[model samples]
Target: MTVDCAVIQRETPAPERPHRRTEGPVRTCVGCRKRELAVDLLRVVAVSNGNGHCALTVDQAGNLPGRGAWLHPDDRCLQAAFRRRAFGRALRITGSPDTSAVVEYVRAQTGAD
Candidate 1:
């Protein structure tokens, strides 16, 4: 289920254009391969401490500070992300948003389950 960060990174905005919005800031789902806007996607980031590491966390607030990746906010989008490993590939890490935790987060964030 692992996608490649290189691919997602290719589509992400260039460093100088962080705030600029392109007509097609679309990203693909590592799971279903759907093309969608990056913002429509939920941001996922990993949390780590001196303790070594923690589960992947879903950033519903879209404000988490580490290297982040995204997925469209939907059950299908979520399934795709997990099944395809978009987060792992996008963030270039082996771990990311905890599944059940992310589902719950998404439920609360979007008000659905």
Candidate 2:
């Protein structure tokens, strides 16, 4: 007489776990074209000058009512943006945006902090 033994294998279900949030909101820098957290970048909005021309102004508080563009607040990025004419395309403006105010704001903020 002969005897045989058999073994069975089965997989147990994984325990249910709560989903964890990984990343926060991210935005691309129009100047450097780098992806970064929205909080880390400065937001700019397009404003009309009442003369059929549009300009960009920095929204330090991140609460403006128009289309917003993101920047790094760095001199190199600012210069690259201007050189590439990214503001007009980003804001969909037909005229050159007055970036003096934005530049001054960034300079002051960077200097202070």
For candidate 2, write residues 48-76 as lDDT tens digits: 88888776788878778878889998877
| Off by more than 4 A, model 2 | 1-23
Which stretches of model 1 miss by more than 4 angstroms? 1-24, 95-97, 109-113
Report the number of clashing residue pairs per model: 9, 0
Question: What C-alpha lDDT values do all the predictions have?
Answer: 0.68, 0.84
In Å, residue 104's CA in model 1 sits off its true spot by: 0.6
Distance from true position, residue 33, model 2, in Å? Answer: 0.7
Work out the TM-score per prediction. 0.58, 0.75
Cα lDDT tens digits for candidate 1, 1-113 = 99767743356666774564566577665556766788667677777644654567777786888887666667777777777777677777664544676777766766743
